[model samples]
Target chain A: METDKIHRWHDMGGQPAGEIKREEHDFALWEKRVDALQVLTSGKGYFTVDGLRRVLEDMGEEAFETMSYYERWVQSVNQNLLEAGVYTIAELAERMEQVQARGETYGECAGSGE
Target chain B: MPHDHHDHSHDTDGLSPSGHPYRPDQDHKLTRWQAMEIAMRELLVEKGIVTAAEITETVEQMDRRSPADGAKVVARAWVDPSFKARLLENGTEAIRELGIEPGVLKLIAVENTARTHNVVVCTLCSCYPRNLLGLPPDWYKQRAYRSRVVKTPRKVLAEFGLELPESTQVRVHDSTADMRYLVVPARPEGTEGLDEAALAELVSRDAMIGVATARHP
Candidate 1:
């Protein structure tokens, strides 16, 4: 039996009054890449669009509300990849460490590539 | 290993800001999640699960789509009654006729009228019609929009500078699961002479999302 684990603000029933901020669709370079990565993975049959939705739906209400749009996409991709056994959590954590270390010394080792 | 392997310690209690907060200073750097995604993507390509060319090609394909596609479709519907009827009946089919593929997800066109207004929201996640409208704007993905829009449709719309009459029923469409919704706002008056392309110019992305109406001539 499937259950709704997380209770999000959007999950609330009935009407409430509030403000909505409006902005242009100016995607940062990383955001654009993440969007493309999502569609590409889905297109490659690595995961279905529905699969991504399930990951998003499973997120805690707080995380869902607080994270930016592409952040949510990144979370979904990470969850999907792990579920698909493309990479292990230990492997991902180690890789993150490596990247962080590289990023720290990138300025000295090589130009920041500005 | 069991699925619980990935469920290792993640501090969900940490309030990473109260809402959808974007970093303007770190524009050049990638977020932690973005870096993870990059690492995973590279690993996948390294493992021969997918290819860089495939991802690049897909990105190019997505880039080709923009609000202009939706604008063109909306503009044509304003001038041609039969096309409007088709759009209302079958969004995917209607869009396909215009050479714009609606992609895998189903698109349902909701028409806004004097008596009723329509808006789209995905409470669970941001499931937009990217095949036609390109990427969703920053605000649409925020907690402020997602959490509020579904609950207070009229109030939220009002905040966006769209106030409805007391009698008008504001219908908020929660885009769940497979189907996506696109709101076809009622054409504004005083532009009967405008051609299709000219009429398209009047349709903004906000109008298609039902936050505002078409710009009047």
Candidate 2:
């Protein structure tokens, strides 16, 4: 039994458009920023729109099906940054740890002008 | 494009421990990618590729866009026959006449008729006409919507409180590329005297998405 038969993204092909529950929610502050971040970076020529789309399309099945739309975009932007050698993996990990250790949310830390 | 090598073995589907989806127990917080996005923005600014002010300006730019813009376009199409002809022919060019930049995306305005209804979806990665319409609704980007909207549009339209007559043919436009779509909803009955602004008020984002018709005034 081949358990993982088809990729979730590929499986979306030709599926009937059906009655999906319409549940709209306000976007989180960070979510809104992520949208802008993608646009800003792309606007600066760090990556093309098609390149960003390709990055999104190439996301793994598990992540694709599970992560929220903007989450995927954030990840895509990160991947693009790393690929462009903006910073090394070690630096990214170190910064992430520093951000986590602040004991306050991103909003708080950024609000304090840190 | 370099692939994301980051591991995501702990990604949850916003499910509760009891197995219900969209549980409210999950408080509003930044997901890992969101945190990373903030970090990336800082890094990009540090690299001199883009400035914080630029990012702020871009955020403001995106914030300024809303469905109200699309409603105005649809409303004008409903009242002005010449505008409607132009919108149906070249959506990108037509929208520019109203000071709206169609941008890089190829926008195609599909008309809804007594016999035909149109809905737009991008099965691949939530490709939407963000220039014409602001950021898509949350539901539009979900896997359930991206997957189902193409195959069972009639059922989906009904879910949006829009049940078309059996004689009305539903057409689902799969936006597979740079070409984005906007469904010009049919002008509702009994509003022949409404001004463009009043008519625009009747058109909702759902109507322009072809999920529902304009509300009767």
Candidate 3:
């Protein structure tokens, strides 16, 4: 069908790959928070699901290989928010720094915000 | 502090009730992505962009959506010819009639027959009908399944332990954009005596995904 020339990295249909891994895990609390952020922000019109998909695709195959599903999603959500001007890089960087200093564990870090 | 009261120490050394290894608890060391999530969420709240209550509500709503919802739809279609017609004609509206919201995406219900089988994949990305079926399984979002399902559906289905006869034609639906698919597996033999609820019990998540058939119970 001559589709090879046009296929992007994320457009993986028909590409040869390894066997499917059947193992599954329940989501972590933080992962659920990431999912919630994606839904809530997009629901509030900060970005569309298309915008989220665009960033995830643009992240390239390396990210697909390395990041867990919600990890990549959180990154994409953050990027979309940046593009939407919900917050600036400076604010994010400073907030991240502050978040890092609060605690070494997610429960500790996430608790201080509320 | 909110999560401090729960005790996860009991499951730390063993598989969870679901028989899968426990995912690391929140007490585990935070990663960079975790930090990013916390920062992003707090920032949005600080700016009054979205309230904390809204995020919690949204997550709860998503948690409420599971394969059982899709199973109910499939079972209803199996028992009622008219509902089956409505579901095949307009999946979103038909599901809505059962009080299940499909969000903004178009839903397409593909019926499996003696000669035709249907399976779905998202070759572009993991575009699942999460509003109807909860989150997709991890395998569905993997590169292998996404890449191979469209090209070699029979082989993929075989991996899922479903072997269709050589005469059966496999139709693969790629969720490339706005549409999502649900496969209504044909009723298993001897299920004629079962009511809707009992039939629903036979519909597993993979069955609706077309990786497997409704189990013979």
Candidate 4:
């Protein structure tokens, strides 16, 4: 579920993700996490696979198959992070702590040596 | 400073006696277009074109793969004569042996010395060695840094607190469409007893930019 305005962003990409009516649901929170509008406004987000696929299609890069949309999205997002001037040793330490917590809460990470 | 798009050559502008922009073509030069591009990027961010969190996540992901330890690699080469030759012949592989990835990053290490100098700038769309350096500094992308770093390298380096000798060659690296540059600054004096981390401490960000030399700790 997404707000009407946020839904419009997905719709504008030419292929909306079904009818997402505004409701207090987990998808609403996920929508917030994956909101392209939010990423764009932040001046520091990357493109998503589904989201990037639509953007690539919009930019006529539909043939690009070298890397997944996820990888592409990550690249731009990393650039924005640097552009935002937020990487210091202390800040990085805190971020690592978050990852450590995420590993504990969620399933084992890709390289956590489960 | 508002500058005419055309006639960027410093010679014609009557600023420098040399026909070239204060920095050479290889050196990074900051111009109005670059500034506008930065502004546009910021605007896109504000308009939800991208987000900060995503970038941070990407960085965390990449850090595990290819870490940036350019200082360590360069310092090793400076001390070891054989490795220096190996580095010159094959930069990517030599650095990769240290666990820095060549697959994800495109790096060009230029040696800086009394006779030869190397300066770097991401001239076209800010193409950088992301895997190696994490994220480039704001100054690396700034038009002022890009343009001046190449065109008027000596002056720009001075601003960054670097003063080179008159005879020292100032080779400005314009990171145009292709690759990102890392300057292998010559070893400083009184650093013989220092360890790798101590040497790295002297390797300032500006030193990598090629405007300044690494200081001895």
lDDT of 3 by residue, A39-65 (tens): 888888989988998999899889999
Q: In model 2, where do residues sit more than 4 Å from their true spots?
A: A1-11, A16-19, A111-114, B1-31
Give DockQ for candidates 1 onward, in order. Answer: 0.25, 0.31, 0.72, 0.03
Better of 3 and 4 by TM-score: 3
Between the candidate structures 1 and 2, which one is better when assessed by lDDT? 2
Per residue, candidate 1 scores C-alpha lDDT tens digits across B145-187 of 7777877778788888999999989888888668888889888
Task: Assess the local accuracy of residue A91 in candidate 3 as a C-alpha lDDT between 0 and 100.
Answer: 98
Task: Rank candidates, TM-score, best first.
Answer: 3, 2, 1, 4
Candidate 2, B1-217: lDDT as tens digits = 3755355424345544433344231244434664576667666677787788877777777878888899889998987899999999999999998989988778899999999999988777677877767878778877677787777778777778888899999999888657899999889999999999999899888888888888999
Instruction: Report the poorest 10 consecutive residues by lDDT, candidate 1 chain B.
Output: B11-20
The TM-score measured for candidate 1 stands at: 0.80
Top-DockQ structure, candidate number:
3
Worst 10 residues of 2 chain B by lDDT: B17-26
- Candidate 4 C-alpha lDDT tens digits along B1-217: 5977575553465333322232221123322222222333333444554444553454344443222366677777777878777777777777777666665345678888779878776543355665555445444543355444555767767776778888988887666433567788889988889877777777765676676788767
Docking class of 3: medium
Q: What is the lDDT of residue B181 in candidate 1?
A: 87
Give the least accurate 10-residue stretch of model 3 chain A, judged by summed lDDT.
Answer: A1-10
Ranking by lDDT: 3, 2, 1, 4
Best by lDDT: 3
- Model 3 C-alpha lDDT per residue in residues B40-97, reported as the tens digit of each score: 9989999999898888887788778889999999999999999999999999899998
